[model samples]
Target: MINRRTFTALMAGTLAASGKSFAETARGKTVFYASVGTELFLYDVDAEAAALTRRSSVMLPAGVQYAWPHPSKRFFYVASSNGQPGGGAVNQGDKHYASAFRVDPATGALTPHGQTLALTARPIHISIDGGGGFAMIAYNDPSNLTVYRINADGTLGALVQQRAKPDIGIYSHQIRTTPSNKTAILVCRGNNPADGKGEDPGSLKVFGFNEGQLTNLASYAPGNGYGFGPRHLDFHPTLPFVYVSLERQNKLYTYGLQLDGTLSRDPLFMKDSLGEPNNRRAGQGAGTIHVHPNGRFVYQANRNSAVVDFQGKKVFAGGENNMAVWSIDQKTGEPTLIQTADGHANQLRTFGIDPSGRMLVAASISPILMREGNNVANLSAGLTVYRIGGDGKLSFVRKYDVDTSKGTQFWSGMVSLG
Candidate 1:
C-alpha cells in the first residue's frame, strides 16, 4: 500500500532523476558526503541504496577550516576557521569570511561565485530560511549571527543584519530555524574550555525572523550548569518537541514548545550511560542528534571517550565511540534510552531517517587519512542501513564502503536526498 508521502516522493524522484539543474534536484534528494582533513566530497545518492554515485568535491580556499552545503543546495559555503592553526578564531578585526561557490551538477566541482563574504565571527555555521530567500550564519569568535539575502542566481547579498552576544559566555555553536520557519534559535557554547570558570558556559537564544530581519524574541540561559555546551538540535516532525545535543557536558536536553512559541525545558536531563568518568574526546564526541521520521525514535553519535575539549578537559558525560538510540514519548515529548553502541565514531555525523520512520541511513568517518595510521582508528568510515525493530532496537540491513579508496577519510557530515 503506497501512501501519499511515498507516492509523492516517487513522482518527485522520477522528475529530478538527472543531476542537471541543482534547483530542480536539490530538494527532497539525498547526497552522500565524506570529510577529508580539510575538504568535503559529495555524491548523488543511488536510487535504491545508500551508496554514492555522482562523486564531486569543492576545495575550501586557504585559511578556511570547514563548511557545509547550503540548505538551499544552490550554493555550497565553507567557513574560514583560521588562517593558521590556533589563529585565535577569526575575530571581528579580521575578514572572517565565507567562501561562496556555485555547485556544478555535471562535475560536482565548486566554482567560485565571488570574493568571500565578510562574516561577524568565524563561520562555523550557515543556514537558509524556509522561504529560501535569506541565510543566517553563526560565528565561533565574538559569537554572533549575520543575515544575508539570497539572490535569485544563488549568490549572497550584503550582510543585512548582524547580531552580537545574546549570551555572555562562550561562542555561538549553531544557528537554526523552527519547523514553522517563523523563528530561529542560536545555541551558544565554546569549542575549547577556555573561560574564567574553567568551563565556558553557553545559552540558547531564540529570535523572530521577519522579512530578512531578526528580532530578539526570548532567551534561556540554561546556565553553565547545563554542562559545557549545547550545539545541535533535532525537531520532532509531528510534535512540537526538540532535542539539544551538548558538547562540553556531552548530554541531551529535551524541550517542548508552548502555544505562545516559548520553549520549555524538560524535567528529564538524559545523559549517555557509556563511560563512568566521561570526557570530551573527538574519538567519543557527541556528533549529532535526530528524530526518526515517524517521531518515535531519537539517535545520537559518540565519537570518543577521552577529553573532548581542546583545553585537555574530559567530556565526562558521553565517552564511548558508538551510536546511541532512544525512544521518544510522543505525549510528553521526552527521550528514554533504548540502545547503545549502534555504530562507530563519526558515524552519526551524517545519517537520515527513512521516509517511513522504520529505518535509517548511517555513515562513519575515517580519521586515518590524516596520516594517522589505522591503529588508533579515530573515525570508522563506512555506511550502514538499519531498520528499526518492534522493540525500537536498531538492526543492520545493508552496509556500504567508501567505494573509492583514494579518498581515504570520507567522514560523513549532512545526509539529505530529494
Candidate 2:
C-alpha cells in the first residue's frame, strides 16, 4: 500500500509540472471532507454530476467534532475529543485536543502540521478569523470560549489571554467571527426543560475582538431567552443580514449586523422552518444554515432522529428530515420559503455547498431502522447529493451509503482551494 507521505508527494508532483501555485490552479476544483470517528476522508467533488469519489483519509487523535479551513486554504484546524453528550455530564471523556493539519492543495490530503494543543473540555464548534490569524473554539459542557493565535507557518500557537472573562451563556453550540473580523459571536443553545429541571435561558454572546483578545460587547436575549435557542448563524455574502437557525423553536430569524460589530436588538424577520408549522413533532429541530455563494438563496436542515422503543429495540420516530430552501429578496434582505426537499436520510447533522453553488451534500449521522406499516427497513448513514437549479431549488441526485458500525459520521463540509 502507498503510504501517506508518498501519496502526498505524488499528488504534489502532478501539479508541480504546471508551474502554478495551488491557489492559482484551484479555481474549478472542490474538495469534500467527512469524519467517521477519528478518521477524516477526502473526496473529489464532481459538481456537474453531483457526485463524490473517495480519494484518501487521515486519522485524528480523537473523535472529530468540528473543523475550519484557514483563509489561505493551506491549512485546517480540527477540534476533537472522546467525550459524549448527555445526562448533564461536564465531560464524559478525558481526552480533548485541538490539532492543526497542512492541506495538500493539490489533492486536499491532510498532513500533521504541528503539536496538538490539549483542551480542558470537548470543543463543540471551531472557526478561524477572516485574516486566518486566530482560531476560535467554543465548549458546551461548561459553556466557554477560547481564542488561540495561529503561527505564520500555519502551526497551532499559544492561547491568547482575554482582556476580560466574557459571560458565555449556557450550552454554546457555535461560534463565528464577523466578516469584518472585528467581532465574534457565540451561540448559546440553552437546555430545554427535562426531568425535574427548569429550562435554561439562551443568548447570543457578542465580543469585540482585536488581535486575538476578546472584550465583552453585548448579549442578545429576547424575552430573557426563554423561547429562543439559536444553534447556528451564517452571514449573507454581501448583505448586512445574518440568518440564524433556532434549534429549540424550529424557526429561522434574520437579524441586522450593526456598524459597531454587534447585532440589532430584535430580529427583523422570524419564520417557521417547518413546512407544516402548526403540526409539530417532538423530535424536530433545525440543524445548520448556509447562504448560497450567489447571495440569492439560503438553505437550512430540518433534522429528526429521535428513537422509540419498537419490538424491544430502538427504532426511528416519525418526523421531517429534509432541507429547507428560501429565496432571498436581494434589495430587502428578506427570505421566502420556496421548497422542502426530502433528505432521504435520518439525521442531517451537517452539509456543504460547493463554492460554485451548483451542488449540495448532506450527511446523516448514523443508521436507523424505520417502521413502514409494521415492516422495518434499515436506512444506512449516507452522504446525499442534490443538484441546485437556477431557481434555487434542490433536485435529488443520489446518495452514497457509509458504513458507520465503528463510529458516527460526525462532521462533513466542502472546502474550495484558494
lDDT of each: 0.59, 0.87
lDDT of 2 by residue, 185-236 (tens): 9999998888988999989999998999888999999889998999999987
Candidate 1 lDDT tens digits, 1-418? 2335543453343233222342433345555555554456676655344344546666554344445565555677666543332225343334466767776555445688867676545566676776667777776666667778777877777767445333333577578777656678887876544454465566777877777777777776664444657777877665566788776566777876543444774324556634332444444456667776556778876554333332333222234655678888756666877777456333345565544345555665442221122222233456666766766677766665554343334235444432
Candidate 1 C-alpha error for residue 369, in Å: 12
Residue ranges of candidate 2 with Cα displaced over 4 Å: 1-26
Model 1's TM-score against the true structure: 0.72
Report the number of the highest-lDDT candidate.
Answer: 2
- Top TM-score prediction, candidate number: 2
